[model samples]
Target: MTKKNANTQALHALGQSLWVDNITRQMLDDGTLQRYIDELAITGLTSNPTIFEHAIGKSTAYDAQIAELSRAGKSGEALFFELAITDLRRAADLFKPIHAATEGVDGWASLEASPLLVDDAEGTIAAAAQLHRAAARDNIYIKIPGTAAGVKAIEASIFAGVPVNVTLLFSREQYLAAAEAYLRGIERRIAAGLDPKVESVASLFVSRWDVAVKDKLPKDRAKEKGNRLGIAIAQRCYRAYRELLAAPRWQKLAAAGAHPQRLLWASTGTKDPDAPDTLYVQALAAPDTVDTLPDKTLEAFADHGSVGAVMAPDGGDAEAVIAEHGALGIDDTALAAQLQQEGGDSFKKSWEALLKGIADKAERAGNAASKAGLA
Candidate 1:
């Protein structure tokens, strides 16, 4: 395999896409997003409420729009969507050519619904469809968490012709569940006489596994094994993905015109400052999968990156490494559950914070307008 960023590009050459796990208005306004697409081989983007909260909170670029939307009676979630959709649409358009170029295999942008409904299967599905339709862009995906209820929602969303990006997955099991949901949804489409090839991707989170286990064990075990845990988990999921693609059940779906649900690596940034900056990028590089890097990580890889050997087709030593952790008294299953739950909560918090920021900004804008007699 080539060195770091070289390996990342090699992975892309092998059919996997490198996506940035972030989005921002400035990225769009200043052409940074376009540059990433052009130079870094990043083909997609993903965003959550936290990303928006930070983008809007620490800047004044959105204040004028908040003021305008506030005057138009939009506030809170409604206002948030208005702003988010605008940015996502711009990104979707930028990726539209790639979408068309790849026949919808690449060039996608993802926006998640409110995280508060993670357990509300129907509600999550409803919100995902509503958001996707509102965006009016085919390359845009509605992100759904991979909770049990979320799996249900994912299946239903795919059946209803909504492209989905499954988020918040922690374990190989959870990733498989998300994949099953995507396939079931597509099968339902074929059964219902609808086109079954709605594009989708299942995003398995990396890095956080190391974060959760960092302090649980002694020095050697707890010491960052660099990207060992995350890359292992990802490798296992990729093996399963390859099996699913080759399975007889899925083969029938493909025969009927359904697209395979691609695997995506989420949260690819290193949690350990001491680890190589591109640890996740270098180790988890594989074909037909995705590694979604944060902005800083992208720059790091672009500048001084070298991808290591290609991930093993049989997952290399992932299971044994996981077993080593298990021997150290870590319950991998329970931790996966905990990580997923926390992931859901984390997003909900960000969503709430984003809404609060919007509300506050709108209020301030409203006052400014009132004082200026622009109201």
Candidate 2:
């Protein structure tokens, strides 16, 4: 590996698992995903409807399978999951050695449950369990949003032994709620004599916090506070994560052989053009956490990113920074709710587009197969 790639390895050495936030069948086929693991220390990955929309809509890498599945009488959500699970299973196998080496602490891939189920706790629960079983891979997580309904589903899913990646969280409170769900599930499992080691991660989205408030900052201090909200929020959440791990409740779980649900930093890519490309990656480095970087952010960091001081376990200056933002009329609590709702809405859009894209591709593939007398 070049010195540039070693920079990324150094961050991994600091105890945070580097996970790529995007996946494409092209990457898997062309060896790009494996290259990331071998050279840049990426141990895991996470995917969303937006990523899948772009991947399938823009590339022909999945064309053959789409055509075959189309001919086999599959379409819509069923067809989509078939495609997604195939890619996730391949990625999971690639990470299997790391999964074994780390004893399941690292080396995992995530597939999000249907965004349409964001408001249906029962539906989300069933979909998460179904997806996990369909993937049939021990190292894969079925992502469930951390919305209120999703929180309910999360507890049930965890109890059902479905590994979960809690997504779309935007604040400490949201993170705590998700963490509580995980705890409750594990506690129930231990009570029922089941293994307490069901794996999980609560993903707090960092950069979107800044993006939502960038224009709302006071004009005089915009330069000082422009991109600070996200990091401050992450610091606050990191402190909560550290505290939870040390709490008596979690201690009991640990004693019962349960693994603490790791806190994951998601949406870490910088959105402001004026900010450093590696802004989130550099600032959110913390031990026992996962940072899922977008492709551009991962490549930028691997090429030139430097790991600054890891996040303070006590959340140094986080409250003060948040207080300053509050003085500017930015209510972090309300904004967190808004962001979560907006994220769900956004994912719903992507999910619709992804299904439509798949349907359109399948149609064209079927038509072509018909013309060729192969259907």
Cand. 2 Cα-lDDT: 0.94
Name the regions of candidate 2 deviating beyond 4 angstroms: 1-4
TM-scores vs. true structure, each candidate: 0.96, 0.98
Compared with the true structure, what per-residue lDDT tens digits does model 1 show for residues 122-228?
A: 99988998998899999999999999999999999999999999999998899989988888888788778898879999988889988888777778746644347
- lDDT (Cα atoms) of all candidates against the true structure: 0.86, 0.94
- Predicted candidate 2 versus true structure: per-residue lDDT over 189-287, tens digit per residue: 999999999999999999998889988988889998999988999999999999999999999999999988999999999999999999999998889
Error of 2 at 252 (Å): 1.2
lDDT at 131, model 1: 94
Following a full C-alpha superposition, what root-mean-square deviation does model 2 have from the true structure?
1.2
List candidate 1 stretches off by more than 4 Å: 1-8, 224-227
User: Quick one: best TM-score, which candidate?
Assistant: 2
